[model samples]
Target: MILKIGKLFIAAVIFTGISALAVSAFAASGPALFRSEGCIACHTIDGHGGSVGPNLSHIGSQRSLSWIKTQIVTPGAHFASGSTVTINGKSYMAIMPNHKNMPASDVNTIAQYLESLK
Candidate 1:
């Protein structure tokens, strides 16, 4: 009985460790996706990207996670394409491409990353 319990505890510990590592890895993927996914071409983050879109250095404070996700997956839901939209007192044309076909995992991770800016 003692050996069985010990083995169970060991398995639980290993499972927990693996879960933690996976969560951390998923969380870390957000930043890399932000860059590799071409977000930098139109959005500025921490003063390091283009000026076409809103500065996202503090987007978390202004937008909810769900809203960010919608903006990423279907920006047209928020603003029509080629229409002028005002954000943070700045005017910008709603030219952001839709990512409706992007993997849901990538969309979630990118939204999670942007939501963490606060």
Candidate 2:
């Protein structure tokens, strides 16, 4: 009976270790991909980053994968039209560069990573 219990414990430990390794690999990839894509320049996450774009500290919780994917693929479409900022008492059109041309797969990866942030 003890031998059977020992075997079960060993299996559980091995499973846990494998799961940990997988999570570590995923975590590493997310940040690495984020840097490679230049997202760090415009967005602040976890209370650190630039101020040019909206805070993404909890974007994962707010946006679904499909919504996130669309934003990445067509950045301009997701944002509201027309510039709300006033310059010289005149409304200036908000300018957000389009990312529609970026590869869908890469954007999907980014979206997945962002969704997992929380």
Candidate 3:
């Protein structure tokens, strides 16, 4: 009976390890989604993308998950008056085009990726 119990415990441990790995893999998908979705066209990640939007090197440390999600969905709704951004030597009104058409799952994945930037 003791040997059987030990085997069961070992099996449980291995299962848990596999589960954790799977979760990590899922979380890592966020970055890929961000890139595939063209977020890099306007935003910079770790100094690698464009500068049309704010640099997102440490965005996770600055904004909450809910705020990030909202911004992604309705960007123009949150900008302050008189706020502007310069892109490619051209200064434009600080209006983030809404990406409301993006799939919710993909938005969430990109949000997850941004949150991990911290």
lDDT of each: 0.93, 0.72, 0.79
Name the runs in model 3 displaced over 4 angstroms.
1-28, 80-92
lDDT by residue for model 2 (1-118), tens = 9999999999999999999999777653656666777777777788767655666777788789998887776665665655565423445354545677766767777888889876
Candidate number achieving the greatest TM-score relative to the actual structure = 1
Clash pairs detected, candidate 3: none
- How many backbone clashes are present in model 3? 0
lDDT of model 3, residue 91: 75
TM-score per model over all chains: 0.78, 0.60, 0.65
**Top lDDT model:** 1
**Candidate 2 TM-score, true structure as reference:** 0.60
1-118 per-residue lDDT for model 1 (tens digits): 9999999999999999999999887664887999999998899888899999999999999999999999999999999999999999999999999998989989999999999998
In model 2, residue pairs whose N, Cα or C atoms come closer than 3 Å (at least 3 residues apart or on different chains), thus clashing, are 83-94
In model 2, the runs with Cα more than 4 Å from the true position are: 1-28, 85-94
Query: For each candidate, C-alpha RMSD in Å?
Result: 2.6, 6.9, 5.0
